[model samples]
Target: MSWYQHWISFAKRLVHVVAKPMKQNSGQGGVMVHPYRGYGSSREVFVMGRVFRQAALGRAIPRRGVLRDTADVARRIFRRGLADARVDIRIGNNQLCITTDRDGYFDAQLPVSSALPVDVSWHRADIMVHAKGYPPVRTNVEIYVPPPEADLLVISDIDDTVMFTGVAEKLKMLYRLFVRKPHRRTAFPGVASLYQALYRGKSEKAERPILYVSRGPWAIYEMLETFFQLNRIPVGPILFLREWGISWRKPWPRRAEAHKRDLIDRMLALYSDMPCILIGDSGQHDPEVYTEVVKAYPGRIKAIYIRRVDQDPKREQAIQRLRDELAHTDCELVLAADSVLIAEHAYAQGDISARGLQAVQRDVDEQQNDPA
Candidate 1:
């Protein structure tokens, strides 16, 4: 066999040996429901979470130490998903029952008979998990409902665009993603400020919806959320992350293009009246996927900002072609070298206020000048 094939075979064997023990020992204590942030409109809501069987529920990402963080990553990666578990969701006076799929994930869309309160952008849903042998587990999940005055929606990718994970370099990306502590994972300079500007839009009280999409697995959700909090970025109502399956047959996860496309489509469908701004990095297939989205959705997209992470001329030329193709449309695809440029263009387009642009510039300057 070729060297690569031999390496894959060896790796698969090693995983089988190491993971079997963990899998067998998992979920021996009790069943738990881990709720994720949900999103909704005035007339309907979407909520989701996972059921896991674990001895004790611990923080997904530990507070300190690289070793503890790495161990937590392993536990999350090999979590024992409780398949076919029943889940009950209640929002205000409305109630619904759903069951977990094979992967222990429960996703439900329920119609809201009464209009949700517009005073607050976030609402809460109570989730209860019931398994055959375990006691019922209950948790509350927060759902984000954009205010009526919201005019713009922001959709951003998390990898190379928001943070400095070298997505084009798989090994380095995995190391930074899995090994680094949440506090240690660095966000791109001024990304938090730029995103905050987009979140606020033109008006200070716009309270627009900012949705974060990632190619990373659901296991890293807590880490990503904590990272955003640490960086002072506005947390989205919900993070759209894919469930990655790893086995001897499939060592790597599937391509993320379809996953990302479906998420953007769902967001567009949810907020039919809102025009969206798409943000992603040019290192991967974001430009192509976003271009397809613009075509599919017509004039729904106001602008597409692709962060230029590398100096590859060919990639730049390809993105430029996409930019040219979008010239006739109302949407403009901007390949920006930094967040300042994006902030400037957004200011000129009237998407953000002058103060917001200045905030982004100040953030960029501070990050650049910091010795650390």
Candidate 2:
């Protein structure tokens, strides 16, 4: 072709590229799926994600530089929720569909006639979603099954138990939540080691199930997931949360204690055959909720470990009362200020190896001695 002809062709291509933003930002949208994790014996599978239009492709993080990255990330998250849309997904041979609630997040629970193979710690299932007028999108979901011959299941709260969120102080809590990136967030001293010991139990190879329960919202799923990854904490399915957009219309959001309670109840029902170890904090109703769990399913609870975060005497006494109530059952409840003590309990209960116990104590001591 002549130079003039080539120039015309190049000009046309540049125009298309420049005009692409207009077409994209004109409110065109599609389906997205988050990583779904759930236990296997329940025969229940859950899929959750959002459908977005206009701005889903671009995150609104106000990244001026490193100094503002964390805050920017928070702003992006605040801008991301409350989108309601219809989504249809196929898991294996079964097709399940649902429309998202006002939160723009869809969580579909379906009992499969045949279990998806879960020969590993997590079974990955590829799912295809169909949204009319949009090209198909595929995402992976994981179904976790308790290991055979496993001794215990661990259900833990995230905010104060695993990490320090200052949950008792709302303003500070929001500041921490919005200002710290997952990589920079703090993990409670010796927590990851203790959880690892409990997960390994007597056997280093043991993959005892760990399910994380949070009162936060689904919008921060990726953030929490990143936190777990960065801190090397063993994580399972995370359950129970409101949608995560900050709203001025509703200044005070609905409490999620009930939602949290419901999830624990379901976990117990699903893992009825396995005794569980519950880890939460005194910051909220964990003690009360777990006490009810112990009563509801006698002998199903192996131990209840509530971290002493609030440091309120009344709260400690209240947890003590809950422990006393469980005396009739085999469950032992421990309310303490450090995870090292819990590691000792786990060791005595034979939930972890002697070496694992040593590791937990050592990590705790090291953290205590760290100048930072």
Candidate 3:
């Protein structure tokens, strides 16, 4: 292996060793269920969640301090998954039961027997976890079902696109992700406004479906959710994150291109009739992966907006080349400097309203004036 790869491998081993004690120190508690938001059509819906044995009381991390923050992040990463657990989900009159896999994740698609009310865009599903000795743990998850009046769909990446993760700089990204307090992590200027505009759409009440796909691991789900809530970014039906499995043989997570493409494909298949707008950053393989997506699903993608995070000339040239290649097609690949540019393009395309555009512009100005 190369020097860089060897160093990464050693770091992973050290992290595992240091965090092992934290895992062992976890107090014996009852079973816990973490249900992610679900999405569906009128006919069926997809639900997913993870099962874990809860930590004891007073194990919660404090709101301040870097060492405590790092420990909290490590605790989350090393939390034990309860495999072979049974999960029961109830939607109105229908009920479905499924078992968790080795990773304690349960994902299933269920047919909707009773018609969901048209007045509401969100529905609820009651979830209960059944472990061997622990009492049944109950929770509820919200599902998003787009109304028929919805005109478009949006799929976006989280890192560097909507938020400032410094993906091109590994050390900075790691510091922001692991060491910094959650409140200190900030989103890009006007990103929340732009996304809210997209959610509202041209009619101002369209309520179009916005789905987020991330290359980050599932262990950081709660952190990401809190970030979204704090930033006021329009929350999507789900944040599709990969399960990063680090072993001696392979010390890193799977390739991000494959994971993002698979999630985008699944979302497209689920919402077959809706035309989608893709948003990502040029920091990694987003341009190439999205180019492939445009090729695979012709005439379905309306436009692609790539945030220009890297200033490298070669990267810019590559993205421009992709844009040129797609010039003849219905899908337009737009490489923009910020969210305001994207919002303007969407407004010009009649995808978002005039008020929405103004809101994004105002937010951009405010952030620029006081970017603390």
lDDT scores of the candidates, listed in order: 0.81, 0.67, 0.81
| lDDT for each residue of candidate 1 in 5-46, tens digit (9 for 90 to 100) | 755554443333333323322323477677889998987899
lDDT of 2 by residue, 59-163 (tens): 443323332333333334444333444566555565676776665567777667764555655655565555556676566667666667676888888878988
Q: Model 1 off-target regions past 4 Å?
A: 1-28, 56-78, 168-185, 248-252
Estimate candidate 3's alpha-carbon lDDT, on a 0 to 1 scale: 0.81
* lDDT (Cα, tens digit) per residue for candidate 3, span 1-372: 676775565455334434333343343445667788999988889899888765542456543344443564455555678999999898877778999998788997888898888888899999988989888877899999999888898999998897777646645544443444433446788988899999999999999999998888876676677668877898888998888878798799999898999888988998899999999999888999899999999999999999998789999999999999898899999899988899999999999999999999998888788744
lDDT of 2 at 77: 40
TM-scores for all predictions: 0.84, 0.77, 0.84
lDDT of 3 at 161: 90
Clashes, model 3:
0
